[model samples]
Target chain A: MKLFKDAGHLFRLAGVFLLGTLSFLAIRAFVVPHSFGQYGHYRGAAIAEIAAHPVHFAGHQTCETCHSDIAQTKSAGKHAQVNCEACHGPLAKHADDPSIDPGKPDVAVLCVRCHSASAARPKDFPQVDADQHSGGIPCTTCHQPHNPVIAAGGAK
Target chain B: MPGVEGFMYPNEISLYWSVLIVLYPFITGLVAGAFILASLERVFRVEAVRPTYRLALLTALAFLLVAPLPLQLHLGHPERSLEMYMTPHRTSAMAMFGFVYLWYLMAVLTVEIWLDYRADIVALSNSTTGWRRWLYRILTLGSQNVSERALHIDERVGWLITLIGIPSAFLLHGYVGFIFGSIKANPWWSSPLMPVVFIFSAMVSGIAAVMLLYMVLMRLRRQPIDMSCVDTIAQYLLYIFIIDFSLEMLDLIHRIYEADESFRSLDFMVHTRLWLSQVVLQICIGTLTPILLLFLVQVTKLSVPVRKRIYVVSGSLALIGIFAMRWNVVIGGQLFSKSFLGYTTYKMALATREGLLVSIALTILPLVILWVLVKLLPPWPEKRHAPLPAALAAD
Candidate 1:
């Protein structure tokens, strides 16, 4: 009580610190099951129910087996640093239901979640405004999911 | 598709946020302009502008206070912005913005206002009680002694500060131009004349802002219209606007003459990316129209009523013009891809915290600061028993 009263208007600082500490602890507490596969049976059961297959898709090697062109394009594009599933979400379904209609994810949402508020992004990289992009140009018009490079990165 | 040599030399155009960062000085230009309008009356004995002088100073100071907010919003971690001060580097022009902001705030605006209103402070100090008294007391800085000699000294010091601040004003806004101009990467932004163009435009915007606010304040207070003051302000606005327009034309001429490899791309960006802001709003509506109206009023010896109306239209246009210029420099620069082959648009979302809300906050923060400043040192002198004669009042 004394500390709270003396804190005056420093409540924001205290709250940020408290939230950070709690998040750290929560991450640590949840890590045990994730690393050990202690709940592997439940996870497999859930995956089977949802995706109808539990085959592990280990990175690009799993992706290249089926779609070599996209893999090659991905490697050549600016998105080489990113994994296919990073944007495509879980690809387990794509492998399982051959007729699941793998329509693209809303590209604007996937891109702007990082690009607009980005810090270390390259200079002259276009910023996506929610209202404008939501209105006129759709995401795929400017960006390609399989291949996203600004003129093949030769654009100094 | 694999091989290409048409790829431009020195390719990195600018950072996404660097464009927005440039807008900081553009806003500061408005501040410098408004402050100079005030100085014309306060320090330079331009009695015809006395009506709007105090209001102009307040407006300048108000905008100056908030000029950094947009830059802060553009930054990834605004909290880390203070590091610019702790870790100042010589090569980075932006690293010096902190110093420029401080010099303008502390040495220019704060000191100028306080010194200019010392006479009023001593009077207000004795009249108010409690917190107001304490506020006035602190503002006075233990100087209750406002004798004839002290008043004279204050005036002298105020004049000196105003003189010194002119270059600082130039630096504050001009340095922003320097940042853009210094960039060898973007042929669009890179120009030796960018600073000159920015400074003149700052003057234009500043004058227009003061003219508008002065008219508004008088209407609110129900004070009689000061035609002489308005006319004088209008004249100064015309001068600055003419110079600013000329400089812009010069910049365009140079670009046309050079016709470098990047010309086609830049010209395309200007037409498409900045068409509305640069051509329609800035050039046609804001500049030419205002200049035409001002010329009609000043040259034709129009009626007082007609001139006043013209001032209203012209001043508003000038203000809008300056803002459009800023938008062109800040938002427009980022539209063109470094590849110079493609262009993109910036979309501002309405519902987000970082969108228009932060801009509103930036605009509002200055008014709050002004209110606090006026509370600390009322810009106008309090009506007193031994007030100076009406003749001296003209001073």
Candidate 2:
């Protein structure tokens, strides 16, 4: 007691810190999510929550049912590996309602996104200068929509 | 989409870290640097630099308080930052910063200040009147003992805290460097010497800042500027700056020597995208100009007025240079694509949450806080009236 005789200030400061730390721990316990750090350092429920969300994008199988002729043309062409909805936006809503018209994608803009001339893409990936090649004409005017290699009259 | 050049990845088009991220390291660097300057007088017993000792500590606290605001504003969900303290990711450098900040703020800086000022608080509580009396009374923490033994204990404990603080200051900014340095994925930020360079730069900026503040504050109060103190501080600033510049050059030379796959892309970025900020402003105006000015004063037998002007110009340039360094590190690192194929641009939005206006406001907020703190607890050595507000000064 003699050592701490005039240390009432230090005692008071310690008391303040003790109360503060305890209060902080209590508040932290209250706020921290129960599911947090369950699997790792994140809320475990997030993975399942994201998974439970409804799936979009009707498969190429779904598109084949409605337009078998286009599917057959796409299968034989240079775009054999590509999917029906790859160029088109998500068609889950249109797939649900058959009457819902998924409007045609604008080939002037759409075709260039992948086919734009760039050093990044592989050498033989069939890229083009959309500005000089088409010159404002829609891509469908020069080539078939499904089989782009075969020209509009079915000649290569 | 508009700012894209070369071959940026689809996801790398829009930058995640903005100008706010630039301020985060810059502000924290000031805190680290200021604390180191204060610790020099306390821990090292550098008698000549005694004038700015308390001012440097107060400056550290003022800037340390504002340091987290930039990070919070940058976060998408600002509220979730607290969760870092609750369950910190053991490996995450950013997450661990919360604990480092809390330790430096609450455990180190605040405790050291209270202990250092306990005697003054108790004495002022008795002498002062009204809310000021109550304010000092609360600061005294119930015990009014300014006894010799009590004061001795405060000094001894404060010394110990300052000893702890020297390394803690290093950890504070060095860890900030580690935050960028440890990002092994980005070649620009992945240097092993980032922490050392950051520490030295922090010291340079922090020293320059206090030197400027001391000169300006003295002029405002119509007091004679302490020439010897400024001279000593300027000497240290110059030396530390040399080390910092050398370390940075070393990193650059090493990068050039070992030209990795990403070097060509980074080289192009430095030439084109980063030329203005990195090459012109940061290098020429910010770093070298100030170094040359300080060097002139150091070597030459200049008049007091001339030396003071040189100090002001050099200090201002040092701060600008450090800020530009932080800008280049945060914004520049993100400008180039990770694939070594492309580059993008950071278009600073106007009048938004993370914008130039908010950043300017955030930069000024610490100075406003320093003003209030100076009024509350006078850091000056001489027995003069505190710079109270007009209404309070009348009392």
Candidate 3:
């Protein structure tokens, strides 16, 4: 009682602070999503949302099913390890309908995305200075993207 | 890849943090530093700085109120930021920001300021009329007791709060440094010395800010500037600036001596891309020039007018230097590729969401808030009509 009389203002201030904190916590409880912490850190529902999106690039096997002749030639050549979609953009629509050709990518632009000279890339990787090596011609005019054997007739 | 000069990871092409991110720490550092300066009088009993104490607190509050706006604006889902408080990931340093910010705002700054101004607020509530009266009454929080005993308790509690506030101030800015420093993936930002350097630099910027505000406000009010107060603040600024510079040099030397793989790349960046903001603006002109000017004032006997001019120039330069430091840290850290083989440019946009125009507005918003706060609080001792309790008034 004596303490309350002497320090009533302090008590009032403490009460106000407590009320503010409680209100903040109550609001937080009301608004926070229920499944937020179910996963490692982020919202678990986010993973499901992402998984529900349609797959864009069909696997290499799907391409081989249609273009077996090109696939066989690619498998026998130096460019065997590279995926079809590495140079070409996603071809889900092309694979869905055979009439859709998905047409050839711009050879210089597509090739340089990976084959451009960079010190950070692996030393043995087939890199080229797009300006010097190609001499303004498209890469496909010299070396086939699918089967690159310079001595052999390119792209059959 | 088109704009890129060398080698950058596909994901590294676009910068995640923008100019507003730079302003976030800069503003928060000012708030922490200003509050720490105010605490010097309250906790450490530095009587010479008492005149600027309330003003410093008001400055801190005004800046603190605006500090989170940048982060909010930068967020993709600003509404979702509340999850940081409700469902914060325990392992993440970013998650702790919400808690640290709340603690500093409510537990330290607001409580300290409310206690310090309680008597004046209660008195104004009684003396004023209409909406102004209601405003003061709300500010008083219904605790209108200004009796000697009650006022004495307020003083004691306010002192204790200041004591707690010193560490809180350190934590607030140091934590910001840790946010950048802890990212081991970025060699430029990864340093244990980052937080210590941030704390000292924060002190330097904060002290300079309050000092300038004191001088300017005094001039505007037609009151003679307090020489002793300005002198003390300048002295503190000089000491802290020296420490900040030393820590930064230490980090530089350590990186140079080690000469790790990242060193060559970072060294090249510092020379080529970051030369202007980092070396010339931040180090040479902004830092060394101000330090030299402040050092001269300390050593030599200059005229009052000359000393005042020097303080203004150095304080302004110190602010520029600190802002440049933040820019170099946040923006420069992003310019170099993670592979350390190439560099990219920050093409600052004109009117976009996180662009140059928005950054300038964010920077000025704090001062406008300070102006409003000054009018409302009237931090000057003479501005308040309600007399201090007889005991404190005697002091």
Q: Each prediction's interface RMSD? A: 18.9, 2.5, 2.9
Model 2: TM-score for chain B: 0.95
Model 1: DockQ vs. true structure? 0.02
Per-residue error at A123 for model 3, in Å? 6.1
User: Would you list the rank order by lDDT, best first?
Assistant: 2, 3, 1
* DockQ in order: 0.02, 0.48, 0.38
True contacts kept of each: 0.00, 0.77, 0.55
Q: Model 2, which residues run further than 4 Å from truth? A: A55-74, A78-80, A84-123, A126-148, A151-156, B1-16, B127-134, B259-280, B335-350, B383-395
Judged by TM-score relative to the true structure, which candidate is superior, 1 or 2? Answer: 2
Question: Model 1 scores what on Cα lDDT?
Answer: 0.72
Binned by DockQ into CAPRI classes (incorrect, acceptable, medium, high), candidate 3 is acceptable
Candidate 3, B-chain TM? 0.97
Off by over 4 Å in 1: A1-156, B1-15, B18-23, B381-395
lDDT of 2 at B253: 94
| CAPRI tier for the interface of model 2 | acceptable
* Candidate 2 local Cα displacement, residue B333, angstroms: 3.0
Candidate 1 lDDT by residue in tens digits, A19-105? 856985676466423433335422334544678756544466676788888788778766777877787766766667547665778
